[model samples]
Target chain A: MRSYRTSTVVALGLGLALLGTSAFAEAAKDITLLTWLGGPDRKVLDTLVTGFQAKHPDYKVKINVVTSQGDARGGMRTALMGGEKPDLVTNTWPAFRKELADAGILRDVTPVWTSKGWDKSLAKTWRDISTTGGSVYGIPYIFGYRSGIWYVPADLQKIGLQAFPTSYDDFLATFDPLRKAGFAEPIAMPAKVYAHSEWFETLLMRTGGPGLVTDLGAHKIAWTDPKVAEALRQYARLFGAKCCGDSKLMYATHWDDAADRIFVERKANFLQIGMWINARAISQYHLKPGTDYSLGKFPALGRGFDNASIIDAKEILATGIGSNPDGADAFLDYVLSADGANIIAKAGFTTPSSSVDASIYDPVAAASVRFVNEGDVRFVLGDLLPGSLVDEYRLALQQFIGNPTEANIAPTLERIEAAAARAY
Target chain B: MSAVDTRLPPPGARAAHRGSPGPAPGRRAWMPESATALLLLTPVILLFGLSVIYPVIETLRISFWEIRGLGRPRFVGFDNYLRLFSDPVFLGTLWTTLIFTVGVTIVAVTIGWTIALLCAFAPRQTSIFRLMIFATFGISEAVAGYIWIGIFRPGDAGLLNGMLSAIGLADLAQPWLGGANSALIALIITAAWSAVGLPLLLSFASVQAIPRSILEAAYMDGAKPLAMMWHIMVPLSLPGARVAIFLTLLSSLRAFDIVFVLTAGGPARATETVGFFMYRESMTQFNLGYGAAATIILLIGVLLVSTPAIAQRTKGAK
Candidate 1:
């Protein structure tokens, strides 16, 4: 009789232990966030996750960081297709949103936005970029000003150039003397397609005018337009110049590596980059912002749109279709909220939401914001164009840069036109 | 014993001579030997059907449809193929692939064969030399690509260009991976560097398998080093050499990651091969149907490239 009594008590204890363990497992809901952010940018995300977990003690956030955008896109696509969706994923702005929506991998967050009234806080352009076919698939976390050219004023002084060139012709002319002064490449350019397209689109916006570039990105304008061809020709000429560096080295160098040339090694006088470069400068080059360097505008080409800036709003974070979407939506809501935008702003990212206080931004980011706000803003052409056309543009531009001659210009344009025709 | 002829014969002899026909009182009915073998092979057959056969058939089906991402595919019979045939870029890519495959196969086989001959005939340090030559096989293709980038990198930082400058041949330092033909040449060298190991290992094994008596007889007949290699070792090792060349050709035809990491089919699509084109169309562009069509075309090209080697190997075997 004593043995039986002991067994009953032990059974009760085991049952209580099992129940407590299950309750503990249910307390902290695991939410996975996938992104391609690295360096200081990754730290910013980690801090945001910590803030979110602190605010919502019942939810635990897991971060999955990929090193490159291409890998991130492919990985997310596979995961969604394989039925293992990440709770939240940060993707390339408009392009990935369109692709994911078409694949039905993205959750419709329009209702979420309307419920929270978060759509009202976003810049109209950013809100429009996130919505496709009447559904909000993503929210802008950061906007990279692609028009900024990083230059050391001292380097320009050594090359006998007193000021940055504001006009296209003047910019082209500066290359010769800079080369003569033994600055073989006045500008450090990465051969990467995305990097190339940033400058290409900037040139297109300044030379072909924003209207035509917008039309071209939307497949409304033919790629063979004489104005478009002119832009390509101009871009080819600049790329082939002595100041653009050796085609071999430029083609082989990565975008981040090329940025390092100006920021750390001082190998080149200027680097065509954006606001995110500051993050890289601080993290990798150990350089101070504003004091170490400053931002300049892309040279104007007199196409009726002066002071226009190129913007890449590629980091659009959103909830995916799977388990813990409510939790994911809650996190994105926090990220896009005024408080969340403040966290992002303090971390040196340019938040698209106006609700966030702007004073937390560093001088370089503040300058970018002021320049973009004061001037006309346009999206990167590659971001707006379909994938096939983007690929064709890269191929055409790279080929033209490879052998930039007057004779090659016509064929390159024709080839690009042929590709554009098939995009739709 | 004659009266008890109902007794079974020796156990082994009885089993070898006759099969069981009916069920014993306590057991189930006997199955035929062939039927049992088929039953045993069922799991492998099912796995092959699920993994390999189903995908190939699905790809063929999808080749006739237009797929934009995971959306419902619309059947577009023969259109993708027609587009492929008419695509100037795809045609250019095909030409590039041909050059890449033929070039890598010929170069890798020749070099591997030459090295194998040296390893076979050398009287001293054969194992050490063999180890040194075969060490490259241990490196991955991606790593091999990065290693070659240092050599082929443009400008003063590059090993090749720096060496040229150091030797007063600075004028010859041009971007090895930037020009039209130059990019293709650089890719071929990288691919050969990655692929040569297999052929070397195989040819070495083949050379070792060659009966020493035949080589000695050739030596007795006054065969010199070159003559013996050309007349004796190579002819005897043709079978292994054929396999090595075929594998190299196959790998080169589908080469994607190396070109992707190295040139990305750039300097004006100068190095764009069919494999890279397919990846761009399918993964990058989300045009799975079009990519499927390109994949089928590449498969056919591979089959055409490998058919001769296979036939030769078969004839040799017979």
Candidate 2:
């Protein structure tokens, strides 16, 4: 009986000591950052967080990676409604910002922006897009240009093209001769949902300019509009080229598979993708930057929309509501500064902050910075639209890719318009 | 059957009269039995209330609302259900669900019943074959779907296409999942392949339970193999077969993983069944109310399709 009592007392004391230690650990955790940063993306984020912690040793930051972009968005939505929301969330897209802001689950960082004097450093377009009803909900972290064409410069030289084509006619003219030069397919087009949509979106931007793309994203204009039909016709014209081979080939190909054709397998010459393709080509395929492959502007198809670039800033850092708003703000301030941006640049990612010098970036990233700095209007396609409607748009474009005909385009657009009408 | 039996004491009274100091029939004899039954049923009843009853009630309640993501759910009355009739996508989803369920249930049950009968008459050493066939039941639905992906994948890399080309039937090796019409067939084939194990095991177990005396009698009475199967074995096994049918039907109606991994309801919403639609609405699109409404409709469909078989099973149980 005496031994039992003593053992119980000892066990109770040990349990109390362990519980107190865990409590201390919990109290010492200063902030939590929920992000979709994984694989190579984590390197820069980890460096920035470590730097922040070193500057302020009293603060300990916890990082929770939510796997993918869509999962992170969905998780943040659920976490906002539940307890235990993170202090800071990074890589949030514009699509989720307004909804979170409206739900009052996001803290307005406008005050932080003003106090830090960040309004002058951040790009005006990003600042405007991140603002919802005059409150900035997102802090721009990482940004880049999307829908840029990637081609092997040597392949282009072999086809007797001295420079990348700048106009629609010149672009189409290169395809046939490139095919005749023993290139099987001049362009590797993947009919996967996102790939097909990006192709159509690029064509639409060149055909009807940014205004039309904006209205479509806002759902103010239906997809069945004549302008959209014209864009579809243009896309079909390119897709039907002999240089494209059979559209059936696309059914088995994903976007990465299409990219592999040029960079890895050396089968195709050109691929229309984002600026990130350059880094992928360098790292994955071990291709030299200017010699093996290079970036070119997606040629302007019409007279009005000239040299326009659609930029997609995929990763945005924002604060959660009912969280440690002060800690979140402090971390955001630290990360958006010139020093922080340079750290991110060193890790091979571009930043939206103008305070970061263009020369700090690598040559490929420097080219993207030039696209933004050279008075090119940046637009994020479908950023304002609801996610479901965006899905409908992609699905419609995929169907059009499956069967590209004059007869099928109108009905496909109508179906997409019907989905858009119900988005609200 | 006779009114005079009411004048006599009930069965419990006769037993109680023979015993000493037990409760009288009119007063408290049933109390202890009832209490014991209540005690025994408590855990399952609590579980049923928690898992099945609560979610069902919540789903029914959410069906009348318009919920977007984790936003506040607003009551829209029957607007969600009423919109179903007008929404082309929902209507098409209903058609896809029906086609998938019917095709899978028929094909799986037929294969299962056929295999069960064959195994029932086979030599005793062929129990290994039964084990091998039933091993598929241990595989998860998602893994099964992935296994079929290699077979139905749409190029030279695909196992089926590769096999066809090697056998000099290259012209027939087209993209099997390229279009809506063909994608539906692929989904059905994959679903049936995964679903056959349940009915096979159930039918075999039930057939094995039949006494050998009946089979010997039928054999001695000069009943041929076909006649015995038609009139004896099949009739005896109908109860288990009906249960298997209902089980397979419900599972096929709720199949999302195989279709999700295979077609993703693509080639223009061709194979988008009710289950996939609900998932897309609730999880993907974050419209909980619409998804709830779809779930309720699918529930009604299952009940309507399986209620008769359930009643028959009950009668057979009695």
The candidate maximizing TM-score is: 1
| Per-residue accuracy of model 2 over A92-161 as CA lDDT, tens digit each | 4566776776776677777778898887777676786676767886577777676577888888898888
Per-residue alpha-carbon lDDT of model 2 for B82-175, expressed as tens digits? 9877888999999998899999999888888878877888738668987776777677777887787678655555789889999999898865
Please tell me which predicted candidate would have the highest DockQ against the true structure. 1
Docking class of 2: incorrect
User: Cα lDDT for residue A145, model 2?
Assistant: 71
**Positional deviation of residue A15's Cα in model 1 after best superposition, in angstroms:** 10
DockQ of each: 0.28, 0.21
lDDT of 2: 0.76
lDDT of each: 0.77, 0.76
lDDT of 2 at B301: 88
